[model samples]
Target: MRKGILIFTLISFLLLNTPVLAQEPLNNIDLQPFLKLTMNVTLVNTGEYPKFIAVNPTYDFKTFREGDEYLLHNTTDLIQLSKANLILNKRVGFWIYPHEVLKVEFSINIPMDLGELYLQDYADLCYPDYTITWSTKRITYPPSLGVGPLCEVVYPHLINYPILVDLTSFIQVRDPEIVIYSYSGEVEFTITNRGPKTMFAVALPLIPVDAKIYSITPNPDMNYTEYMGKFLPTYLKSQVQNAKFNLTQESVLFEYTDTLLSTMSSQQNLIQNSITTNEDIVDYPIWIVVLGENSSFDIKYKFQWEFTR
Candidate 1:
């Protein structure tokens, strides 16, 4: 019995000291760039005999995109992960042996197409208030209690905020009509405010080359369309020419300022006489006071050529 015990100890020492050889079938676990956007993982059976193993990651096995290509670790042989039947059940082939690691490398590509609408939603879904989750777990059969078998990993990553908010969701443009003939025409359209708060001034930026404004007026919508045109054509023709200053590349601004009021303080004010209540405060859609949250209004821009064609 003592001789038998001595032989066992000697065999154990040799096994411990001997380095495991790389076999023809490459029996070993493999991972590429362990910290990567798409992690390549596989389990190999280094032993000559077949072994049963399974991966039970916390993530749903089917979450991977379809048609992604996988490989048998070091071999040129290609495999399609989506075609693997066992993966749907979150298990590995009972016969998976040396050099074969199940490929879990895949990217989730979520595309947004709604332009500014997408930006608005992205801003609301980013950072401290929201977090997306990803996790994984592993299980091996022929269970050895507490020896080496089960494992789990999970985490949450933060999203970028400042860049997403700068996108164009706050300003909206719609239904514009411009007809110019012989260097004279009218530009009309309604701009809507889609922001959370009130807006002071909105830019109308379109002006014909060397054109002098004839008149600017607000045509009320169906709610109050019966009232006569709120602006005096003769008076507005002058105010607009003076106030309709343009800056290259920037939008033309239609502003209501007290600076323009200084000239009329001693005379009858067009704003006080022609423009009274909030209805007249902003023409049809262009707001003078507060373009309250998400409101639509209109502005009529009429112009004539400074040098007649």
Candidate 2:
């Protein structure tokens, strides 16, 4: 009888201590409509056991600029969990008991140098929609049953929140004034910013080639220039053949030489025609003009083109 009682007690203890499988935790993301860049996230552990939860937040810049890490605020507050762990890749983790709710608040800061293009894109009804993704995982503890999988049992889930941007009170850029000198091929461009907020490091595109550039009114931080070209495979092959061949050719090789020259000439014509027919293949030069807010500056440059009769 005692043996039966002992066996029954052991069975009851095993059944009570066994870990039960549970579904993923419930998570909610909220972005304050009135605030500029504020977000709140709530997480609830619905399981019966304690869970170690980790959250990783990421930004998806759909229309606005990408790879701007400086725009996201790092510091996050975990309201329920008295302790917060700052993990890798802007992740936050904490421990929560059964039926407990955790709240996290995030605040993002907008820099002064966020260019005029972003605002203009938004104003044109081109709404720069941005989304934030929360990657979360919960590991239930009280350690799984014996000889089970060594890895922790984790339930993973993802939550997405769309960010709202209001640029009505943002800085405004006025139309620029341009002057051209026909004789010297020199041009002057003036830009003005009328603003309630200060702007910095604004970039304006200049469409000209082989230009002599200067910043006249307020000196710019830096000037950036780049030249892009498209080279055809046939042109490259002709160049290689020309480089490999010698000027002195024996009579036996003369016929072959004439054919090679004819081929090269045909290839050159093909390359020229290809360039002329495709507008996208033409070489382009990019120049960036940097400016400040509530201010004006003049940019002077000389560029010329020649025509054949």
Model 1 lowest lDDT segment of ten: 26-35
lDDT of 2 by residue, 1-309 (tens): 432333344333322321221221111211111101233334445567765444323211111112222123223322222222333344444444576554434332222111211212111111123222323333233332344345322111111111111111111112111111111123343334432222222232222221212222233332211111112113222222211222221101100121111111322331111111111212211222332434544443332222223
Alpha-carbon lDDT of model 2: 0.25
For every model in order, what is the number of clashing pairs? 11, 0
lDDT, residue 96, model 2:
46
Candidate 1: residue 89 Cα off by (Å): 62
Instruction: Give the Cα-based TM-score of candidate 2 against the true structure.
Output: 0.20
Model 1 C-alpha RMSD to native: 31.9
Top candidate (lDDT): 1
Q: How many backbone clashes does candidate 2 have?
A: 0
In candidate 2, where is summed lDDT lowest over 10 consecutive residues?
254-263
